[model samples]
Target chain A: MNLTIKATKNNTFDAVVVGSGMTGGFAAKELTERGLKVLMIERGREIKHIEGYDTAMKQPWEIEHRGKTTNVSAEERWANSRFWGLGSEEVVNHLTNDKENPYIEKRPFDWIRAYHTGGKSMHWGRQSYRWNKQDFEANAKEGIGIDWPIRYEDLEPWYAHVEKFVGVSGQKEGWDVLPDGHFLPPMPMFAPEVHFKKMMTEKLSRPVTIGRIANLTQPQKVHTDLGRASCQYRSKCARGCPYGGYYSSLSGAIPAAMQTKRLSILHDSIVSEIIYDEQKKRAIGVRVIDQHTHAVTEFFAKIIFLNAGSINTAALMLNSKSNRFQNGFGNDSDQVGRNLMDHQLGSGAMASIDGFEDDYVYGQRPNALYIPRFRNWGNDKQTAYLRGFGYQGGASREGWESGVNADGFGADFKKSLTKPGPWSIRIGGFGEILPNPNNRIYLDSEKKDKWGIPMIVTDAAFVENDWAMRKDIIASAVEMLDTAGFKNVTSYDRPTHMGLGIHDMGTARMGRDPKTSVLNAYNQVHDCKNVFVTDGAAMASSSCVNPSITYMALTARAVDYAVKALKKRES
Target chain B: MLGGAFSAPTLMAMNHWEQATSPTIEGAAFSLSDTHRKIVAEIAEMIIPRTDTPGAKDAGVPAFIEMMLKDCYAQSEHLSFTEGLASMEQVKFLELNEAERRGVLKYLEQQTKEKMKAMPKGTPFWRLMKELTLLGYFTSEAGIKASFDYVQIPGKLENIKLKPNQKAYAY
Candidate 1:
């Protein structure tokens, strides 16, 4: 197919967001509401609110394969690695197929993602947390990496702004490390979790709280206005929530942006590169390859926001080399694909609680109890590692699958399974992996994906800091469970490689100097002011908590800055 | 219960003769032989015998396992499981009684556990049998309501103390 430059020199939008995901959605909404005509391009198919979540209302028995993975599809398509549930087939079709978009892994990495209008936001864990002052000051304090150009104070207001709009359900304990957020009513804790929390506080002098999730326990005006209801506690948010209970791009940002009537969205438009103009010294627009027809096209915009995730966005920038910028766009520092980071996880344990057989819960709780980071805090800075980790876990009665070996048949088995099984709890850690320049991702120009874009080659691996933290992560969980008077407490530490956490960040890190980083404080490329990267790519450090919430806040703040800068003719 | 709607004799007939010998049903291959199918059906019934409710055969667990194995299990897993069944036949070839056959199965269970400890990889034959047995039994109406009480649309959360005679949930 022939390429057509629809917008010659006049047809330029106020802003162009290159992804309709967690960050892109917020960017579109914030930019459009600021009275700017924003054009959002998504690499995947269009998924509308409520109507697109066909399997959200399905019961346990209503699915085929009963949540089991099949070999036929798994072998045929490499994208099956991202496919989890029974009803995730349609969404799986939109994800980057492993066979078509291959990446060489020095170590095994589970890069789970779904590329759609809302991107992985539709399937996010929804656990939102604010990055504390310490998290912002980590780089400068430790002298590990480059200092973040902006501190927590600059982004705090934006966090509150996004939090209120997203309707986070969290208890305000006033912790300095994690900080409080603009929250809706917190989800009630399970009795076991409450019991454990009390015990842990009394014994260890550490606090355990219900996870600061983005699920609306109590519907606020913002949620109600957005046509979202309180969570029905279905725990099936991964399939996409029809009630719009959880804060996804589809449930939150996209609809708000659509309300502005200034935003236009084009899905299945895989952005190949941001076209850089030599004379203007700014991004003219972007070239997109239509996923279905393989048709190449270009759309013009005065400003461009690349929120196409961490690796992909960085790869695009690396692929956008021109006569002026020979190495790559904004590669003066050569840090465009350096300092890659991901949370190290799956190193924890579960134990059986003999009691709570009769007392069963109402619904599958979407959120888990969280144990905030206790290491490197206050007088307890003595650790085998420098950074810290947090735990997310829950207690529940065992299902029928738990009693496989029990001797019974017809009547006895039926009667036994009608009630709840023995109570059990699991605690898993999400530890921070410090941004190491050695841990990086680069564009493999030799290989091209199905979209004809250069494949991202990852060469990241967890180091001693991660290994040291994981030891305590497992031991602490076992200690808590044992202290709670729980019997049969056992600990486990699964072997994990980097990127398995699926929280990839910091490839195009923000720094005070252009010589040290790709993006500046406001997520604008220091060398090229017209281009911005508000995704995980701009993260200076990988905080212990999930990073998507932070990305949303950053995107909103950046869009506000970008729109104002454009008005001021700064570009 | 849905399982009780089918009589014991009817289930036994279905177990022994009905659709067991058919190599192809509607152009789809039905792999297991009649005798092999009966063994699986009877073995599953013995594991969760008919006591004051419908048996494994009544719950259609035997059929469920057969279909699940054919569709879901890898070729190596299917071979291992069939090999396990053949070993059981080897015990019977030594002119062992029904009780003796059960004793051999008990021994096999212990051996399987030891093997699992040594190698924590893909699902083994005994593990597959156990998994299928649990899945089929729990999902069955008699298994769900009788063995473990189920509440469809449990609207509210209640924290009630367990009675001495309270049964667990099937699922």
Candidate 2:
């Protein structure tokens, strides 16, 4: 069925947000509160907040495979091979099924994504950290790629704005690389972690802070007003938190946007392209295909925001080719699909600590300890690489799985396993992959998905710089453990593949020059004033920290600019 | 090209071949007869030995291993396991008469440490037997409560240092 709705003179809304995930949710909430009639389009099925997480409350024994992947479930694994979360088998429908819609990986790139109403915001690790001043000014000073048109100062207010609403729990140590944020009370460190932190700070003269996460260690007014409660400390967050303990688009942004009553969300509407009017020289509307009926429809808006994630947003722009912009929409500079980047991880060390057998953690802590970036900053330059990486790790006592080799059958083995096993510490580094033009994603017209849209061909890979950093990531971790006098210190570097970090960014980068970038300082398309791409695609550089919090701040800032531009047009 | 090479039917046939050739314990050995398969399954049960908690058989461990060997294990793993099973049978025959299989198993337990270290990590029969035996035994109601302290809903965060008297968690 083909459905067409003609836009009346007054039918156009103040804004149209293309996704309902981390950035899109923030966009909707920010714009709606600012009095914009925001229409949010989500490609996945609608899910009600607590009710949607079917397996969230289930115990380990309750699952059929006991969290193990079965043959039938293994077939669905390819769809979300890019993502890293448990219960993925039961929640396969929320992600893009690779069998139905496969993307070509010229080099093995795991483009893990969840396309549902909440997008990746539902599955995000929730480790929220602010990008220090160095992160914003690095590209400009180092003369790699383009400078971030907006600096830390420009985003500081917005960061404060979003952090208060999001309820980030972290202690303020006033570190230069990691700035302080308006935070709820920090979750106390486990005993082993406290020991490690003391050693790192005193011995290495380095700061080791508890993970600055978007989890509520203490309930604040914003969360309480929204009818959300504190974390039950279950640590089963990726399965989806019914308690609203962790921040997700479903629990936080969407509900807040809905409360404004000016925001409308439409699910299962796969947006094909932004309808750019050549005569008006602005994005007038968007064309979408109904996922269920395969019916084509059109919705008009004065302003269009593309928050369909990095690859999807870039593909949409490339697919939206017209006579005026023949190569692709907003492709005048030909930079729409270049400079794709993601953090390279899967390189770290795990060692057994012989002592501390008597110590065991009380509950499963949802967050890990973070070692902020100490290398290649403030006169501490490395001969090998320019940018640096940070470590996220923790120590935990072994459980029943530790008794795999131990001898015994009935009562003896049972009695032995009641206490915790030896304490072991493991740390993994999230190193920045520089914005090289060679690392890119392109539209493969030869291959089409189930939606009939051309498949995204990813050709990105880690270069020598990333490999060089991996060496330090392993060596430094071992050195720290050895210096701390932990016995049996061993380091490991697991072979890492691209896209494993799941923090893909920098495809449609923001820059001052239209010739060098697709989006400008305000996240607006350099060529099209009315179009904005506020998701990871607009990132100029991939910082070592988790990118979700930055995405939220950028989205809030972009919507503020877009609303003002819309008002100026009206006046 | 890779997809074309391993069509669904071909993959399934390969899986069945691997399963049919895999080695088994004295109680459970690979043979053409269904009765032989049943005997092997029973022997697997004896190795784990059912008690208050569900044993290897009760946890469907033997069946799970059989299915895994057929579907997941490589051909080399199947051959190695089969060889191990044949050796076990030879040892049992030499050690005692038909009624002395349990006695032979008891002797094998004494030599388990050296024998297990000699076996490779990926051998199908031994690996599956070991994994399922542990999984089935531990996840059983008796295994969880009696063997280890099971905490279904640990409502609060404590992060305590374990005392000498503290019981181990069943996680």
Candidate 3:
């Protein structure tokens, strides 16, 4: 009995974070640094910083397929994902093999996932933008979905705090559409991109700026202290940056949390269930299963944070059923895996630039130009759609890939292939998808993965407003490119599904009422106060922006609130 | 006298093969015969002949092409490629002179473009050959280092003025 008590005590901590991903990394950092003993659990293999990047510096000759996934198994792994470059050898290990982890796509959901220590942070396109005041007010103003319980002011300070630590590199555009944040020096734009931006703003009357990315442009003391440095312009971040130039969980928060010495990490341990106490009416602990060995272990904690991304986070809650909460953990609202939302994308335009062949970029900028949302703003309201969409793209000279169509065969032809081809400008729209109860993911009790976890059944598609918005998204992209006076402008709308954006959100959303939402204003489960979810799952609305930075801010805020509540209760 | 030992194309290919002294690789999945390999090698050279810098054959592209066909391509997809070579063999491609070979490549190129309309999920033979050779050659070390301005790490990302005859960046 004494041995049992000691073992139980050994498992207990101040907090247990269910993932070591983007938000979980921040949660661990915030909680531990605030003097809480924290244990971050991850189902994927732990990646030690720098050294774990197996193919970061591999030359083109060294890669067998030369960046193309021409092999059968590799094709099947990335098939139907619709993401173009994830199949390359450089980042293959970072992606989840689709065959091995198949989700039942009821409506062809391209559910791309990354289950690793850093999670999708390793593979994230680091475009970080703030959700303006309108983004928070959209749902309530338009009656599209449930209102966001907290407004932008609630998250403003948290965003600043997170950005200060994370080192966001961007220009402070004074536009209300994209609220400026704490940022490092902005990365310089290429000549063609600069020309495109000028033309776009001058003609189209829209704001176009260099992409607000999370790369370290100028390393500060806070960044350098974390062993993070300035960007090397190699653009090999997909394989994991050896120099910690960009911010992955491994590159930033995890290390900071480790420095606090109040943090313990568990890799390859999947959090299967959040254990709720019947008497306390709160989450007391969690049940974890070893991803490899399949051995189950129960861990106790005062506070538990679920940051296992949007999909797996909802899955974990739905799987954790008890006598009191028979539906799922914190499912008193019956909204555990509903109100699914993701950004609709993969529609864009490209055009060739005839002149200015006498200019070239020196380094890989590793960022694109951003055209902020213009449609459906205050004065620019449209009857077609409720919310607006932003465009992300840049201009560049055509590389060797363009040579495939050109007639080529000898010394002169080969010489032409070697020379830089005509400059071309491209733009893609990332539009907002309104939250719908039908567009959701539920656990399939019939099927289980190799790890014995229930498989996710995704049923989501673009609805009426979404499709209506997409037509504009495509039209706007082409208009911007064509109006910029580029030659041979062409538009393409590739096959896109809900999860293709990989911005899986609004599953267990935060709202005003516990009856209508899973999480409260502070991202704490309403029925279960000690348990919080600060990942994409907590998003009430799918704002038209890259959401990783928002997740970081929310996670930091939740930890601060949770820790203060814990201390206050003790007093 | 030299034509007696080999075909006319082989006699021409031998002249280029002296630069590509790398031993023939036996692909575990797929590979071509010595005659077919020599024909492909000569085509690779013609596509990117030795200029001021080393050409495709010098970069040992024949072995890389075989490796790509072995691992990257399916048997069904490469069958047309192999059959295309056989068709070329039927037309005495091994005996064709330089100008005739160039015309033959051009003819195959046009034919492949027409066949591409009917072909599903795979490139036609002539298109595949040209693309594969390009893929193999340009990704090779000699192509990256010798031909282009290879920069392993550019510390700055500012826009630089493009000079005359500036080669593309080998990133």
Candidate 4:
């Protein structure tokens, strides 16, 4: 098992960043900008910006089977097929193949992942919200898990830094539960959404605002200088925005990093293990397996950034077995793959609006309206759930496809479909799932992958707090819809497993204590300060919000800290 | 966290995408005979006859359905479809005049509605054929261009007051 792998001297760099995803792209950009020669290793095929978006340029009619997922695709892509939008022929190409990249699921876990250059950044739901002050102190206040080492004030500047570069579009709502950030021109709200917002404010005393999204409403100089454009309003964002209308890694950070001329990226290179120096007690390099030839190569670096997503980041660290740290790299606390958490979803309510038959939006707006969490924050503490949940929903006039199940055919049916149907509004909740030590992922040592690396085994599920929050998610959503004078209001709550949210976090949690956590407040591993995990893996707790922006902020902060630390050491 | 949670509202936006693959209708693998192809084309035309917009037959919906049935549908559904084709052939439905073909379809539609009410498990062949025809036609360029307003990129979101008879947006 001890096959000797020689370190390639030519591949040495100041920093080696694993995974060219949202955080990895940021790490590459920030590190390279800070004067470090950074090497970014991406596990999937190289997906170039704009030109690599094969499905974006395609018209509805141009796609085969009318963009339907074929029978072969359903059988072969069983893991990804369950994801509503991801399984389509128009989008499936970007997703990771389940058969090739298999993982053991103790329970039903929907692990939707894209391993390409941009990773899930290209298809991410760009709802950027800053974690509130209360969110940082929640774990300690509630006595749930270990407290977050850093507070909102610590991350506020970094959040603003990312928001300015990313070009988030939103209105300054002055909400405390969800802190607002630097924003571009907000996308216009639909008439129904406007009505719903008013009703929620008047009746329930909850703030419903247009979603603060990463989609560029108007291209700022920061974005235009990078050759990115404004939003086209096509709503074909998940296909990968060709116009760079959205802030994907492909359109944003990757290009910014390339501009530095200090960043070098290697695609199709899967990081198997981090080469730890037993004598020095630090990570020196990483072993990579070429996805094409299965050739193994070692690239040495002064510092390492593990931004290879949450589960995979844990998997890589756990697989990195050194004589000094036998449990795993920087895992003296035994917290490398513990405390897995994801947002509890698949619960909400919807209703049909009676009027607004003539009102319609002209273009396909990519973003929706978001109701900030009003439960268990400040004076609104709830007895049912430990943490709060937010509602993200919108209203739209039903279009032609409604004719699919309708009775009759010919001219009448054609006319029926041609004219839009009644407007309907619905809101679903993304509830925060409390992190549990038992809900974790580990490497199945007995099962070696195609690259001879151990496969990941996930044992995570929703706890009582999650289900209780889901009930409130449904109840609150229904109450809002009904108060808005919506007819045919219906509440829905379906059982869901972790990873379905695609916001999986908290495996290698950050904390103040080296004995209790894997990473420090700066996202550096406790025992091994040279190696950092700035991705979702380093999250101490899952905040009830989209986590990518926070990850970017953390990556930027971590890189700044690491660069300063490295500079001081050199002096 | 807050953004993608609008799963239900977004479901409407995805409605057009879902039309191509209805969970109830699984396509099958079977070649359409020349005689059966003629009958299937006529049936499609009956469901979406020529009007201001191109009908299902003109939009090449019959061929689309044949491909869908062969590649997307289940084996049991394939047998049911082909057997229904044989029964129609016995009555020489395709050989009849356009008016007579319409009348034949109307009768089948009535039978299908009654059968659906009596037993919900088995979908009537006529209903499946109609659904396929509708999917194929609407997804076709001719059907979309003629019936709905097709805009690849509107560039900006606009507040519009739609007239009662205005065409819906084709994504």
TM-score of each: 0.89, 0.88, 0.93, 0.92
Model 3, position A182, has a per-residue lDDT of 90
Error of 4 at A252 (Å): 0.6
Tell me how each candidate scores on DockQ against the true complex: 0.29, 0.27, 0.55, 0.44
Kindly state the number of residue pairs that clash in model 1. 26
* lDDT tens per residue, model 3, B54-168: 8889988877777777777776656766766666666667677887677666655555677787865556667777787888888888888887899988877877788888898
Model 2 TM-score, 2 decimals: 0.88
- Best-first order by TM-score: 3, 4, 1, 2
Q: Which pairs clash (backbone N, Cα, C closer than 3 Å) in model 4?
A: A546-B1, B26-B73, B27-B72, B27-B73, B27-B74, B28-B69, B28-B73
Interface RMSD for model 4 amounts to: 1.7
Two-chain DockQ for model 4: 0.44
Scored by CA lDDT, what does every candidate get?
A: 0.77, 0.76, 0.84, 0.85
Runs off by more than 4 Å, candidate 3: A1-9, A70-72, A75-81, B1-31, B74-76, B117-121
lDDT: worst 10-residue window of model 1 chain A:
A1-10
Residue A73 shift from truth in candidate 3, angstroms: 4.0
Fnat of candidate 3 is: 0.82
Which should have the higher TM-score, number 2 or number 3? Answer: 3
Give model 1's DockQ, 2 decimals. Answer: 0.29
**Model 1 misplaced regions, further than 4 Å:** A1-11, A76-96, A356-358, A405-414, B1-31, B48-60, B91-107, B120-122, B139-171
